[model samples]
Target: MTPESAALPGAMHPTDQSTQGCTANGEMILVVEDDVELLELLGTLLKSAGYQVAMAKDGMTALESVTRGGVQPDLILADFNLPGAINGLQMITQLRMALHRSMPAIILTGDISRLTSRDVAFEHCVQLNKPAKLKEVTFVIASLLAQQRNAKNDSERPGQFAPGIARSSIIFVVDRDDLFRHTIRGVLESHGYAVHDYATSEAFLADYAPGPPACLLIDAHLPGMEGVELLHQLRKNGDDLPAVVISGSNEVSIAVDAMKAGASDFIEKPFGRSEMLQSIARALEHSQDANKKLAWMQEATHCIDSLTLRQRQVMDMVLAGFASKHIAAQLGISQRTVENHRAAVMTRTHSKSIPALARVALAADLRV
Candidate 1:
């Protein structure tokens, strides 16, 4: 149906209004969702809450409504999983670029986990999990629109800082169920992710590729190295690999154990497409963050490793909370020499203070 047909009479229609005017006010709301019933439901809900509401069935229609029809709303409440070339995320991104403004948005979806930090990083944007109550939805919409108005009033305030895009990573599937594992791999591959699978944790570890960013999706009841135990082992081995545990039962105790064992997320068996995708996406986002930290730590460690033996001794003593005079006495060196070595240690590590040096050492896992 066309945008006009989807709205209640005299409520929302194609606009002759400028994008600037629409963005400057909180008078209209654009709803983009594929579910017909939910679409009508939302239109009614928003109208009752005293707001003009426009509706679209998919992302392409939503994008065209704004770009071609000049029907940009002050706030967008869209579902992430839309049909056609653009999804909800793509449509919002395009709109932001086209309008040259960070429009307020509410990302309504079944899975918030699937979205990375960069995807919902815009100002006045909030994400709500699907099947939310109407009251809660309206509350978020009103809250964001209020913030938008406040920001517009400021006029000279700077926009929010947007982080760089997150890198997609490989997904490792460890499930003894051959059929289930195959199905999972097929789904993830179709979504454009690199995938690898193993029936046991031992096999996964033996052939693991440490150079690339990766996350694990393991069945809780494996033949050997039970899923939670595998997470425990990885954590014990100092591996911060993000993981999701799946089980046939939805036992609270099992989920608790998995979480305690360092699993990033947990899902019950026989999950649907959205469920699986959200879990994997959440896990991969964690993996991306872990990789970033790993990179920073490696660089810091390399810097620390370059210090001379005497400088290193001085650094260690400072880290141990030794006074400068005591450190000099122990090293059988003059206080002036000790001070010089300490200064060299600071310069080499790029640290301004003892605590700063300590953080670098701990983060890089160097000997303190």
Candidate 2:
């Protein structure tokens, strides 16, 4: 069909509601999704929030709708995995070129790696890793559109969305046993924790979402990629998402292996609900403590990285208990100059004393 003559499949002409007292300014939003249920849900959500909504099943149709004048979308929310060969990122790029300008977009994907700057750099594009809550989705949409058009700052009208589910923590349960997984999920849900369970490690990995306070429960004897192996792999990939290995066997050796693989805790099967809950609480605490330590180390590393080569040299010598005169003689510079460099290092690192500077180096894992 020709661009102008072709009709969009699921286009809705929502009344252009006033921008006053509302986040939506009656802008058109194109939603490209293959999941029929999700498409309808999003359509309803947007329409209620006072937006002109259009729906396309795939990237090709979405591009056609915009390029053909059937729908002039002000914003686009597309699923990363679509039916055709064209992915969400590629579709966003082509859509921009067709429109003759860049526009704000949100690309929802299960792949965390797609959140890299390179993929989201063309314009005011944002990558929201999947398995995200509906409120998160709406929040991003509202914020991006507001920035794009300088719309009203009113929060999403309170009654426009599903009643907010107050969740304490998110939990992932990976086990080969469907019955057991469901049981655990039910328990977590009853406790007001958002829980998702998978029958395999691969499935869990496929839907892994980063940047959330979450933990994992993995069965030690999983059919493929056993729990300890999964923990090892996650640690190797530098993912510190705390995990607890659940095993049917109670061998000390298995627990030892799990600990070595970076598991925060190990639990034997036939465990009580209280035991499981306690382990999860402890694991979460461990995760929070680790996060604090990591934040401190990141700040330390940033300070150390800001130093010049001379400042770093002086810092190293000073940290190693070398006097200013000794550092000058070794580097063939004046003692006064060495002292000046040391002062700069201390100031740059925000260290008031030599011992404080040494602590920063230790946090950064820098060698003396």
Candidate 3:
């Protein structure tokens, strides 16, 4: 479908148009598209639907807008085949790194077949085909925004259980082959894991939620979206469920692509049970370690934000490798006072040594 088709009558539902002229409730959206007319149309559409819209013509410009950081978007809509070296996924990845959080996003693509799984493995993201119906676009945006709101509310709720603690032990299997799915399910169930099998990736995605500590075993040659693409979708949805990709071919490139798409491991067909179990164990461990590190970094950032002006100064000097006497001289303070401030910094930040303190500082984005 062409861009002109998108603007035809009956393209947008009556309910969607009813939102026009309403206040946006402070939600902001970033739209990145290279086509000038399409970009304007999207921006106008979003604005009419009660959203504050920001527009960028390419991936580079979108990235620059994010880095400059005045208006942080509540959601992002980016074209997949953006001009320049950085595509939409890369731009979203860069923004996520800078913000240290997963931001919701949607990718619009003209030729969905041209994209590989590696192009979609971004946290809190989904893809939509180009010339997308206005109703479909509005529905996706509303769903993502609603999910974000629910997540925030849950986090802020008092006395909530920590993430992954109450998760079900159900393993998900996605494969086109009936025998393969049956075999895997039987094996996993024998090992004390409840198993759910699906013949298509779309079926699995439709039923997926982020509430389970389960692992995914997916076949590389599914009928619709490939295994790698399924893994990418899982990651983009902010579901950190560990995944293992099973492929009949022993091609190194296929394995590489699977791993690049964020699969925990790639296993060739005819694998032993022991090998599969070990891979699953390792993926779970990796997920645990990643969660721990993210928690520590968030705590450290909070600690850094609580520092006094003098304490922060002392920390900067300490990170710069300055001795106590030198720091005292530089700050026009006594050596004993400098030592006291340093001790307080370490105590408040829970740093055992200078190197540990430096790690906390770096995680908090402090520069010396």
Index of the highest-TM-score prediction: 3
The sequence of per-residue lDDT tens digits that candidate 2 reaches over residues 1-368 is 32212222333222333334338889999999998877877787778777899999999999888878668888899887889988886787678657644567888777666224334532336777666556566667777787767744322222111112215568899999786786677556645568989998989889996766788989999877788888887888889888878876746457556665767667765654545665676567657777866877799899999999989998887766678899999999999999899888989899764534655676676875
lDDT of 2: 0.72
Poorly placed runs, candidate 3 (over 4 Å): 1-24, 114-118, 121-124, 152-368
For all candidates, what are the clash counts? Answer: 0, 1, 1
lDDT of 3 at 126: 81
Tens digits of per-residue lDDT, candidate 1, 166-205, equal: 1356889998878567766755664556789999988998
lDDT of 3 by residue, 119-228 (tens): 35313358776556676776678777777876744221111222242133667888887866775665455455678899999999888777657778888888989888
TM-scores for all predictions = 0.38, 0.37, 0.41
Clashing pairs in 1: none
**Candidate achieving higher TM-score, 1 or 3:** 3
C-alpha RMSD by candidate, in order: 14.7, 20.0, 22.0
Q: What value does the lDDT take at residue 320 in candidate 3?
A: 68
Model 1 misplaced regions, further than 4 Å? 1-26, 114-118, 122-124, 152-368
Better of 1 and 2 by TM-score: 1
Q: Give the candidates in order of lDDT, highest first.
A: 2, 3, 1
Error of 3 at 324 (Å): 73
Q: What lDDT score goes with residue 46 in model 3?
A: 78
- By summed lDDT, the worst window of 10 consecutive residues in model 3 runs over 154-163
